[model samples]
Target: MSKIVLYWHPMSSATPIACALAELGVPHERVKVDIHAGEQRKPAYLALNPNGKVPTLTVDGAPMFEALAIHLWLAGQYGVERGLWPAEGTPERLQAMAWSTWSYVTYGAQLVRLQTARDMGTPDDPHGQAGHKAMDELLALLDQRLASQPWMLGANYSMVDLIVGSVIGYSAYIGAPVQKHPHVLAWLGKVQARPAMQIDA
Candidate 1:
């Protein structure tokens, strides 16, 4: 077994990575970086991740950063063996990669705009309205996909579901009006019900 250490902070983007680790049931070490205290910006942490973000993983002393990249790598390395990742060179694998990327790249982009607008207390502004519109379109796409299948990659649950679901769930948490999409709400409920998805806030 590789020596895996996860550097994380509470209630951040790192939460999803922690959830993934739990689902995989991998034995690893957890190091909390107190972003509130600026620990993430310290030189020691920056050496491992110049981005100076939480949720950096060290596998046998080699560091990897970025929440999405870490999730993909973990799914490939640990999740494949645990039946939480699709096999390599398969259509399901391709779909997994695509949907996972869409969750972050396509959906996450609009979500950020919405969040920024909300943080600035101008959620009713044109920028916020645009973000909401884009998000609704994206949610409709997700709803259509879930209407045909139980999970993201079909019948069985996988890391793709976790990855996509987490992003959508975060949007809903931040007031994205996700309840309007029934199919998406239902699918997200199922994903969230997993024991491994539970985390301390």
Candidate 2:
């Protein structure tokens, strides 16, 4: 098998990491961890990623976790430019990283929390409602931003698109609508149309 093995679960955020790898043409074996079955809680997964999160990749024997970090490393190492990043040190690069951070740290957290509450049968939770509000505000902010730039970092489809696009997919899965942002809808349609954009576990 290839040295890189990606431990993932379909029910998690591993989808974006997979999309990034597919964008880069990096072939890795998918180690399915039954998250619902508590597979990720097993000792094996904990050894790889103490956090027990999906998208933990063992690249050439080195373990790397977190979807965005893995994608950034892959983009740099493989020279795969799906418009996910720009040249380092340039204005474009700066903007791309900013948007990428916004997607993961800001928007992604809110969406994940909302989904977690609903998945654990806490759909009507007060915190979940707050998370939904955060999500809506984030989407509105994103929509306003997209009103100008074609992509998150100017008119290019860098890692920003992959990251944000994946978040949009998650929100949709949790009953959050993406139709409100016309630009996002158009951009997401393009991202999802990628042949390598597989929803692999």
Candidate 3:
């Protein structure tokens, strides 16, 4: 296999891809992109990811961004039969795609909004309230979907769990009220307990 390098910053959204790579058990190197110190905008890093984001993955020196896309690609290339992702053409694979997309685009947007609102003002502010409403509805839906399943794609843990759980876990950090969604909370517990998801002290 070609050399895999992840340009990353700890605890940012980039963390999940690290978890995914660990779950895949692929040998890789980490090149820290210190966003707070403006390293992501340096000429060399920008050449790899014009967006100047952490979690840009370089496979044999070919760069790929978008954390979810990186996750899918890594899983497809190295995780077959390892259960990090469903095999291509299977119905479970399609479901995984849907859930991953939902977690990234739909749920992720509200999380961003809430975080931004927190920086701006109280959760009672217009933007914050809107974020809460949107998240409440989405979490309710997810809670129902997860009501009977141990993981996102039925019984098996897949990339969907890691992807979705990463964003949902942020809710707790951001002080969003998600405890009402029992199933989602329980599912998150299982997702967080994965060995790959743990960070060393």
Candidate 4:
């Protein structure tokens, strides 16, 4: 077994984490739980996370549930070794960390709303409204930020983008008109274009 065991569901919220592990170039064992089949509610998985969400990283014998926390741990531990995260506690890195946190709460929640609608087989109005409201705010923020820096962390591809961008892409995937936000659209294209992220790879 690999040192890192990831519990995930394909196309679920945990997908981005798999992408991050790929970027880290570390071998990880992916144990898929069928959320669609209600396997996430099973007793076995509930022991690890009471919420029964996927993307829990079992590291050093501890289970971490939150996406940002797992991403931060991966970045803090493997990022510096691989030069992905900014130096520890530096202003630039901390700013990136702030963006990462924002992504989970703001953008991430919006995407979750979209996904919820998709899962419910509805046309996605109320959730779309929530997502659009979030997009409007975050897109503007990102546009203004990108106006100055090439990447989220001042021209470098830091863990912030990896975590946030992964969660945000669900908007576009669920038929969000992200093209309206040119900066965000461009940013998504840039991040998705990474060699590690390509589907056929």
Q: Which candidate comes out best when scored by lDDT?
A: 1
Model 3: residue 176 alpha-carbon error in angstroms: 2.6
lDDT of 3 by residue, 1-201 (tens): 799999999888689888888888889899888899999999999999999888899989999999889977887787776867788999988887888889889988898888898987676788888988889999999999999788888878787888889888888679666888899889899889989989641
> Candidate 1, residues 85-185: lDDT per residue as tens digits?
98899898999999999999999999999999999999989999999999999999999999899999888999999999999999999888789989899
Q: Which residue runs of candidate 4 sit more than 4 Å off their true CA positions?
A: 113-127, 199-201
> CA RMSD for every model?
0.9, 2.6, 1.3, 2.5
Model 3: per-residue Cα lDDT at residue 184: 89
**Poorest lDDT segment (10 consecutive residues) of candidate 1:** 192-201
- Weakest 10 consecutive residues of candidate 3 by summed lDDT: 75-84
Whole-model lDDT for model 3 versus the true structure? 0.85
What candidate 1 gets wrong by more than 4 Å, as runs, is none
**TM-score of each candidate structure, all chains considered together:** 0.97, 0.85, 0.95, 0.87
Q: How accurate is candidate 4 locally (lDDT)?
A: 0.77
Best by TM-score: 1
Mind giving the per-residue lDDT tens digits that candidate 2 earns over 1-201? 247788888756787777777776777888888888888888978999999878798988789888888876776666334445576768876776777778878888888778888998997699788888888778888888888987777766666777778878778678665787787778788877777675554
- Model 2 clashes, total count: 5
Residue 93 displacement (Å), model 1: 0.3
Between prediction 1 and prediction 2, the one with superior lDDT is: 1
lDDT of 1 at 97: 91
